[model samples]
Target: MEKFPRERIRNFCIIAHVDHGKTTLSDRLLQMTGTVAENKMKEQILDSMDLERERGITIKAHPVTMIYYFPEEKEHYQLNLIDTPGHVDFSYEVSRSLSACEGALLVIDATQGIQAQTVSNAFLAEKHRLVLIPVINKIDLPTANLTLVKKQLEDSLAIPADEAIATSAKEGIGIDQIFKAIIQKIPPPPSFPDQILRALIFDSVYDPYKGVILYVRMFSGKVKKGDKILLLSSNKTYEVKEVGVFCPKMVPEEALYEGNSGYIIANIKNTAEIKIGDTLTWETGGTTTALPGFQEISPMVFSGIYPLNSSEFEKLKNAIQKLQINDPAITISPESSVALGSGFRCGFLGLLHMEIVQQRLSREYGVDIITTYPSVIYKVSLRSGKTIEVDNPAKLPDPSYIDHIAEPYVKSYLIVPSENIGEVMQLISEKRGSCESTESLGHDKVIMHCYFPLNEILVDFNDKLKSITHGYGSMDYTPDEYRISDLVKLDILVNGEPIEALSCIVHSSKAESRGRSIIHKLKERIPRHLFKIALQAAVGGKILAREDIGAIGKNVTAKCYGGDITRKRKLLEKQKEGKKRMKTFGKVDIPQDAFLEILKTDTKQS
Candidate 1:
């Protein structure tokens, strides 16, 4: 195989809002380039994970190299296409993907003019100084508004409406036009073969047989088999076992050069040794400076995950480690719950990310686990003039020990139909959000900016926003400074014994109502036993609400029909004494489903 000139390599990625036809456009591009055979073509070829396909969302960013034969130029160009996730949770992934490219394909749905994320990701591409090629997708739909969408692209993004390519990715219409535009509009990557080897590790995955495989883009020099390489971040050296490019799949190559994207295998046994955004260079080379890496990603939502059965704890641990190899954004720490036993307090970028991780553990690793309700980190200021960050409700200090508690906040950006402005504002207001600003995008679209507690919007804000806006709303948020708030820890007790796993941090204003709802739900789920079970919700040892599951009735009077009333009363008294003793010494066995149900319940509804 011959190495293509660096000037012929066009490295770019597709970025857009969720359900904006990014993956579909990628599939059409692959087909036009003959990279994938027609018979083997499938929907969302870049989305390899089953969860991504089933959920109709891209959870991970994927890269593939294609050979496009430009008929006009009568030459073949090497095109590298990176598909990125559209959700805000994976915005970090989008930023890293942009670093490896010189251009980006900004796809937008024709029916949905300009979404919050489309604007957010467009600014991200501009931040990376990548060339942006606007593509209006789904043009074949009945409700497609090409004129309005084109105007939106021009007004919001400052991209010329004429430059935007109209396409129907589903029907393969205007695909050839898109291909032509790519050749003319997108610039090629710069070559730096004279410099020492410096490859940026954008992504990686662990394989049981091959160990850790790194997906990287070479910005300088070359890497080949048998070459000794050093990970600059870790200062670790290893011999390169193989180097290859992904033609939709890993294909071994003799070497990878500048302006190329490919994979590198160095016989890495432990995933911890390889870090995303780390620089890879030749061990003996003179590359003194490393590439500017990505910013550290902090988790926005946290929950405790435990194995359903205590014996499967090791399996759960191993499964999480394996999953972490592919997804480094998750943060996990060991935690022990008095009621749920051993578990890990896991942190995720958002609720979707949390759900995906849980589903993957169950589907891929067959690990049945229970997860607690999610919470955001809080800063608690103590009377001693010291402040501590608390991520778990069980770790919250007593009310008397703290001066004030601060919770994370976000600057939320929302775009919705103008007619639904009232509904959207009401929804945000209900979540403790305050209007920061509002702007009119056009005749039909309105942009609203609000400041909201991060915990308030982490769970169902998006769902409610869409519900009120008739699925025409889009939102993006960035973390703001933490502010002092009236936060308290709500604890649940079963049979008068506190269950650490069922505790949650909530606003003091809603503690009473939330507590009542929790106890009520527990009463319906808990089973009746020989002894009555008491479920109570308390805050700082003051019980706010309680519920009781009546004990199973046993007839003591049936055998004493001919006896005196006093004899019956004496038998009842003896039974009451036994019940009292059982309530004091007997342990209540809380079912796993009960814990799961509590976590799954929407706190707002509760």
Candidate 2:
């Protein structure tokens, strides 16, 4: 009902490693401010998705506006809290949230101290010039070591040990202290109301009733209902049907000014009309200058997603398009597999991202789908002097036409306990990683820097790191460069026919081993039938590995048991001849489970 001065606004985000209390802290903050009623309070109020709540992780970045009363100053301040995803897969989400805020609450688990993501996110916040408020969360646990964690924050992130706020978000302890620190420390957004209208679209969601709703942060101007707005990137104009702020839910407001974060609805019919980093301004501003958008996120993993029933293809496409309205990071293209029918070649940020997308497609859309093994994009230089990018093995060109292949590389950073350094180093080495440098972090921990092929670590590197370190290791990575390497496309053939869905591009040095493992797994998965099946792994035209599946046992000789040996031999010959004919005409029924199993196997092996 009352508008606060620009100086009384505090825009901030809570960021941390997975399961480090970001959502919990956000929930407590909402409770303290009474934005959410005590009886209505729930765990992870910002994580409205069932998947996020079930998994206890934040998948999407959520923004909420709360009013906090400052007794000392006798004033009310508008506090905007943007909660971000903690997993490395959603780092880009964290970056976008930071861009909308002036400060961030860097939460750390007191029991675990500083993890890899904590440091990585801290650097991102610093890059955006955000005021970092260090907070050690989960202090009520018996294992919480306040002194050690403070030291770790100081030694690792270079934050002042005394400046870190210690709080228990679950028990509502020290929440008032966090509020006071935010009001006194984090500065308000810069006031630029007189300037041309400019607002950043940080997030969006698709509503069946309202179409597309955009969550934005005003940086230079104000917006109101019934005003015409222009999307600078797309050069599209729409009448603002409504403008409001998120009080955990959209509440209509008369107008939204600079230094505020809220939503805008313009009757957008499709998500393709707007982009996450696009700028919005007054339709007649006559200025083409756009605000700085976020860096485009490139997908790190690729797979083929196909519906179980071919008739559901249209529904699958529509569902994916709707999902992309909210999550634009996923990349999709048309693809067809002889064994799996029509499908889309999809790209994702990471394994978790790939899994989440699959889960959402099945759970939210009620579509049963099959996914192929995940792979990374490869840069292929042909002898004809043209460089092409390939994400699917089926699209790989002939080996004779290829000059060389270059794969993506990443600068990987890992933090592990000193006792597990040897095991971690060995694991990296096995993944074809080259150590760049190593630094000691206190007496019991070490930080390692390495360069690894994107494909090599795309599958099970993180799982292996955790297993070897007994769950004490964390990792973060950034794309470094692309380097030329010896690569080959390994194809799987069943009954002398190659299955494009099972084909994969692998490094030449490990081609034989990987091919053998694939063929062996395929043999176990292909069921026994009336005809024997021959499974082969080939590179180009050369067979690298092979496996044979024997035909199902039958009682062909039962009728000739009392007869002479000649009669039995005749029956056997006839049965063998029949099997040969069946082998030529019969097709192998590859179950959907087989495709999923192969992908899971690759994760376990690679």
Each prediction's TM-score versus the true structure: 0.95, 0.95
Q: lDDT by residue for model 1 over 186-206, one digit each (tens)?
A: 888776656789899998888
lDDT of 1: 0.89
Model 2 per-residue lDDT tens digits across residues 451-558: 999888877889889888889899988788999988899888998899888888888878888888888888777788888888998999999989999889898888
Clashing pairs in 2: none
